[model samples]
Target: MRTFFITALASILTFPVIAGTMDIRVLSDINLSSLIVSPISGQYAIMADGQPVSDSAKANIFQLILEGDSIVMKTLEKKIGKFAKVIFTGVGKNNIIKIKSVVPAGRIRSYDDHLEVSVYAAYMKVINKVDLERYIAGVVEGEAGGVTTNEYYKLQSILCRTYALSNVRRHELEGHQLCDLVHCQYYRGRTTDADIISSTAATKGMVIVDGSLNLITAAFHSNCGGQTVNCEDVWAIPLSYLRSIKDTFCIRQPHAKWKRNISTEDWMSYLALKHKYPVEDSLSFNNAVSFGQAGRAVYFKDKDIKIPLKTIRGDFQLKSTYFSIEQRTDSVLFRGRGYGHGVGLCQEGAMNMTKLGYSFKDILVYYYKGVHLVDLASLEFFREE
Candidate 1:
């Protein structure tokens, strides 16, 4: 969304540090109607509408339901009255809770710090107020599953923290900082993996920043085929740190290559219907069917016609914009390279780099050009100076 890099960078420096606890809406994509809450670790205090309820003491299990504009809070023994909002505050450190959705039938999830339950329209709103590092660990676990090198997790943590800090104001009007979805970051719940936890803790206050000391967008994807693209190519904004670079580490990884086949007739119909391509012209028809890509091109060749590869990717549900078309007998074979947008850091590339004994700093610098890894506190201190 940045227009001019230097001018927009100045505004990002003024964002407040939302440290300590982060308010993230859990099950944000689900239309939850009811849920079961149970504390897993440490002490917890339940309060309704900012007041201590009678059933707050020794309460092991609590049930919450959405009733009109109010939240119906109750325990196994008795009801705790209806209120506009129900709050669950942890007394001390490592206060975890298990939340299992009952209405829509969701999985049981564990969260840290505190929680807030309220009614929003037809669904029950559930927010998890978790500590910063714990949230980052959860995000890493959700985005990058499977046991891998701690170095990769550490790299992921910095990127997640950078993204979170930069976009903290994204959902300010919606009451919470971010959602538990890909819209922000995939944050399922608190991670139990020791390596992930330690990796997150290792990069506690670190983040990637541009030359102006502003936090970068920290964009990442599954794989980049063989080369990462420039920011301007994907989002139409030129960021100095997001320049294109050739990467050999991810070429042999999974999701690096994919293929699909569509009928030549269907492909021609699509071009004619969508772009009003001149199907009658012999040259245009020949070029469309037989196309090759040595490197990534923004447009597919059709003589005088220029079709955006991104548009083709969306229309055909292709993996990436980098693809080549081959004319078969009746079907047009689409050989695609890479998955996702092919911009920023490649996850598989970075993972392989870590396996080769590259540090997180080295991998980050290799992918993101002309960027500096700085502590959040140092940035604030320099801003004041």
Candidate 2:
């Protein structure tokens, strides 16, 4: 299946920005034959874009409706005698809805079930329905709290990319049919709306190439026990973009955030009483450290390639084993553990940036070095024809 470049939804803050096109790898995790939307009632409804549609329509896949818009479906069901929109996408023996999107007749929307699907369909490969319900409830029951920032965006991107890449149809796209999963590396959807397109656009041309600058067959990973893995060692594949380094260790801080009506002391007190920590300074640090850097470690197995660790000032050097955070000067430096997707760019690093003065753009650059910012307009300039 062919994937289109991202739209203005995922990148540009403003909706009216010109568009760009790219290919995304789709995996079996989310395929045209993958979605399992069930109709709430006997009468299932379809949505062309956001408007309502009847049951009878030419619902073939890959029916491109427009450049940026999409044809989505929402089941119209009676709630307490009043109709409510539900996930009832009309399940039958074949368990498929009479989809009426104009994107294509046979193309699917690539949605399934997962936790972070709150922003996108990354949650397609769900383990169980019970887990899926708990996740949705956790996010919706106000347990995880309403998304006030782009954290939802971040989570969704990771999920989508992960799913697409996991079911990679082939290693080099040599014989296997081209895919549309993030695992395949690129991200393009048949018919994505503003938000999805915008997020993808933001990361456009941001292919995770190997050190040789060749498409490295990149795959994003979550917190790596504090030590960032060498691209080649971690995945056993060379990255075309991220270079093999003299040292794999980089100083990253715990992202601090604006007071969520919280305080260091009061928060500690809550932790002590509600969670289970003592209310002493030494105990506090020990408790946090003991629990924080406890059981995580990332190692570069190649003996020849030794990645050194040091403080920003080049004063203190760290050992090869699990490195702990050392309190340095102004920054209270982190000796730290795990690599990308760890705390602060270091997993929680983005949150720390949000706490600090850095915007989302700043966060992306900090982790992805030497990336350039290009307008989606430039990407779509000649393609508009």
Candidate 3:
């Protein structure tokens, strides 16, 4: 895909951008969802994470996708993910939305502060903000899907804020690591992509975690013995994120396409011995769960099978929590499922919530502990001189 980026801001860095409020236009090719409700981002008059997005903040790129129902956003880096939303409340003409029955400025936040935006561009050039916005408006002038030109203008405002929020999260809170680095987030494409941004914007500011919101850190895995894992064994964060097994709908386990008729025992042997683990004729996959069923400290070829409490507790954001040593038909089977160091906010789990009657808010409160919705309009009171 070919895209052009216009952001001069660093992808990672603390707020209070070093420069004095530099602005630019963004260009992308994604049919964005309604940005008016994106929970994770707030315009300069608002904030990310549902708070008031600081005025000083700016997007890594303000895009002007001069194209169709979709535009491609390009960047100079590879990223894991990004959060975005489309704003609906027009600049005027009775722009209002209700949250818990209170009508505030036309702003919204995504649930659980969970908005991710990523662009797949190894290298690109920058453009001007003014020209970019104009270009974007022109393309969406008379398009399909019933999105009016006014709505397109509102999108320009919304994405500007959404992209800025992602810049801060990925670069600052995350230490400026490129998401595509694998170990980092992972870059699929621009938030403006039809499939990526549009779907996301549709449910803008849809809450993922809420209620007590107390450092809520629930956890989940790729697969659960057809059952959810016990909270203690899987939790690395606090009660803020300790929920039961959740269906992420992201299932398509590896090797699903391979036509293998090997016996279960053969599969274990291939997995263990091939991975370099010494395999004895008596080794088994059932042992993977021995620690749970048995107590005397299980071992594999003399290695203690029990793991430390700290190793599996409180904020290990880079690994899966579903792990075990089971007795396969042959060699012992050591297996794990899921992603994200098993701390909090499973992306797949949240997707499952979307299927259920639970709106984003329900999902957030179910996973996290305590929190409440605060009006971002209050931000008007905190402008920096």
lDDT of 1 by residue, 212-275 (tens): 6778989999998998888788889889988788889998999899999999899999999999
Best-performing candidate as measured by TM-score: 1
Q: How much lDDT does each candidate structure score? A: 0.87, 0.31, 0.30
Q: What TM-score does candidate 3 get on C-alpha atoms?
A: 0.36
- Which pairs clash (backbone N, Cα, C closer than 3 Å) in model 1? none
Q: Which residues of candidate 1, in runs, are more than 4 Å off? A: 1-12, 383-385
How close to the true structure is residue 342 of candidate 3, measured as C-alpha lDDT? 36
Tens digits of per-residue lDDT, candidate 3, 254-295, equal: 311111123456544543554443335344343322423222
- Among the numbered candidates, top lDDT falls to 1
Can you write out model 2's per-residue Cα lDDT over 224-270, one digit (the tens) per residue?
A: 34344445444445443343322122235322111112234543454
Q: Candidate 1, 95: how far from true, in Å?
A: 0.2
TM-score of each: 0.95, 0.34, 0.36
Of 1 and 2, the candidate ranking higher by TM-score: 1
